[model samples]
Target: MTERTAAALRVVNAPWLRPLIFLLLIVVMWDLTIRIFKIPPYQIPAPKDVVITLWQEGPMLLREAWPTTVATIWGFLLSAAFGIPIAMMIAGSRTIESYVYPLLVFSQSIPKIAIAPLFVVWFGFGMLPKVLSAFLLGFFPVVVSAVQGFKSVEPDMMDLARSMEANRWQIFRMVSLPHAMPSIFAGLKVSITLAVVGAVVGEFVGSNYGIGFVLQRSIGNFELPTMFAALVVLALIGVVLFWILDVIERLAIPWHASQRQDVFLAA
Candidate 1:
C-alpha cells in the first residue's frame, strides 16, 4: 500500500484523536460565536456554561433520564416486534402490500403530534401512551426497509435456490432475509432516533416523570441552564442508543455491505 493510504488509515482508525479534534473545533467556534454575538445565556448558553449546567444539574437529570430512556427503548422494541411481521407479510404477498401500503402512507402523512393527545386519551397518561407514541414514531421505517430488503433479493439467486428445491421458507431465510439485513438495519437505526423524539413528545403532552417532563417544568420555571442541561442529556441518550444499534447491526450482519471496511476506506 502507498504511504499516503497508510497515513489515512492510521488517522481514521485512531478513533479518539479525530473526535477530540472535532469537539475542540466545535467548542472554539461556539465560544467565539457567543463572544462575538454577545448572546445571552438565557437565549443560548456557551459550551462552557452548558458544561457547568450539566454538572450542576447532573443529579436531577440522572433521576429523570432513566424513565425516558426506558420508554424510548420499549417503544422501539415494540415497533420492531410488530413491524417486522407486518413487513414480512407485505413482502410475501402482493395482495397484502396493495391493501396495507396506502394505509401506511396515510398514517405516515398524518402529523404524529396532532394525534398525540388522542393517544393520551385512549391509552391514558401512563407509560402505555408514551410507548405507543414511540412505537408509532418507529413503526414505518422498519416495515418499509424490510419490504424493500425482501424484494431486493436477486432473481438469479432465487432461481438458483429454486433449482436446489428450496422451499419458500428456506428461500426467504437463506436468500431474501440475508440480502435485506442491511436495509432492515438502516430502518432500525432511523427508528432508534425517532424513538427518543417520540418519548419526549409523549412527555411534553402530560407526564409526571421522564426527562421531557423535567424539561417542561424547567421551561415553565424559566430555568435556562436546566433546560440546556436536559437537552444535553437528550442528545447523549440519542447518541448512546444509536451506538448500541450500530453495534447490534455489526454483530447481526457483519457481512453486510454497509459494514464493509473497504467501503469506509474508499469513502
Candidate 2:
C-alpha cells in the first residue's frame, strides 16, 4: 500500500479513530448545511454553537446526565438479571416454553410508548417507573436471544456430550452457553439502545433531572443549541456504553465464530 493508503488502513483498524472521524464528518456536514442554507440557529444550530452551549451548561448537563446514566445502567442490569433465568428455563424445558411463549409475544406486541402514562400513574413519578420502563424495553431482546442461542446448539455436540456422560449443567456450561455468547452480545447491543429510550420516556412522563428532562425543557424554551448539546451528550454516553460492551465481548469470546468473522471482515 502507498503511505497514505497505509495510514488510512491503520485508522480504519483503530476503533477509537473511526469514531473520531465520524464525529468530524458530522460536524463538517452540519457546519456546511447551516452555512449553505442560512438555517436559523433556532432550527438547527451549528456545531460550534452547540459546543459553546455545552461548555456554558456543562455542569448542569453533567448533573442531569448522571441520573439518566444510572437509571439506564440499573435497568439494563435488571433485564439481564431477570431475562437470563427465564430464558434458561424456557431453553431447558418444553413445558416452560409452552407456558410463557405466548405471554412473551403478547407483551412485546403492545405499544410501550402509549403505556408511558399508565406507568406514571402506577409508579408515580420516581426512579422506579423509569427503571421499570427501561427494563421492560430492554428485557425481551435478552430473553429471546438467549433462548435462540441455547436452542441453536448443535445436535452433534450435544450427542457427543451425552456419549461422554456429561451432566446437564456441564452440557449447558461447556456447549450451550459458549455457543450463545454471540447472540447474547447481539441482544445486549439492542438492549442498551432501548434502555436509553426507556429512561428518556420515563423522564418525559415525569422527572426533575436527567438528560431527557433537560432535553424536554430545552425544547419548551426553544433553546435549540442547548437541546442539540444535550442530545450530543446522550449520544456520546450511549456510544461509550456500547463500546465498553463490545470490548468485553471481544475479551470474553475471542474464540467464537462470530468474532472470527468480525476480524475477517475488518481485514
Candidate 3:
C-alpha cells in the first residue's frame, strides 16, 4: 500500500478511534438498509427516529434513569463491600472455601429472572427489591475474582513478610492487597455491568420508576422509537459506569503491568 494510505489506516485503527468509527459505520449501514428495504418503523425504528425520540423525551428518560442508576450503584457497592471480605475469608481458609464455594455456584445456577418475582413479593415493589436483585447479580464475580487475587499471592512473599516480623494484617495490606488489586478491579468492572442488568430485571418484575419501566410502557403502547430510546439510555448507562471503573482502575493501579501497557499503547 502507499505510505499515505498506510498512515490513514493507522490513524483509524488507534485504540480509542476504532470503536467510534465502527459504531458510526454500523449506524450508516442500519440507515441504508432500512431505506433500501422500506422497513416499517414498528419493526425497527430508524436511527434518526431513535435519536429524535431521545432528544424529545430527554427529561423523562433522565428522570426514569435516575432510579436504575441509584439501584445499580447501591447494589454494586454492597457487592464489593461484602464480596471482598468474603473472598478474603475464603482465601484465608480452605475450610471456608470448601463449604461456601459450592453454595455460591448453586445460587448462580438459579436464574435471577426466575426468582425476581420472589424478591418483589417479599420486598413489595420498592427500591429494596431492586437493590437486592442488583446485589445478587453482581455479587458472584466480585467474590470469585477477589478470592483468586488473594490466593494468587506467592507463598514465599508471605514467608518473607513474616520473616521480617510483619503481622498478618501488615502482610495482607502491603503485599496481598497491592498484588490482588488488578484482579479485584477486573471483577468490579464485570460486577458493575451485571448490577445494571439486575436493576433492570428488578424494575421489569415490579417497579414504576426506571428505564426498564419506560421500556415496558413504550412496548405496551407499541412506541418503537421510545423503546429504542430507552435501550439507548440503558446502553449509555452501562458504558459510562464501565468507563468510570476503568478510569479508577488505571488511577489506582498505574504501577501494574496492565496499566503500564495501556499507557504504552496510548503513547
Report backbone clashes per prediction.
0, 0, 0
- The digit string of per-residue lDDT tens for model 2 on 157-236 reads 99999999999999998899888888888888889889888888888887878999999999999999899999988997
Candidate 1: clashing residue pairs, number: 0
> Model 3, residue 25: what's the lDDT?
98
- Give each model's whole-structure lDDT: 0.89, 0.88, 0.94
- Candidate 3 regions exceeding 4 Å error are 1-15, 261-263
Of candidates 3 and 2, the better by lDDT: 3
Off by over 4 Å in 2: 1-13, 258-266
Worst 10 residues of 3 by lDDT: 258-267
Rank by lDDT, highest first: 3, 1, 2
Q: Model 3: how far is 105 from its true place, Å?
A: 0.9
lDDT of 1: 0.89
Q: Any idea what lDDT model 3 has?
A: 0.94
Give all candidate RMSDs, comma-separated. 3.3, 2.4, 2.8
- Candidate 1 segments whose C-alpha is farther than 4 A from its true place: 1-13, 261-267
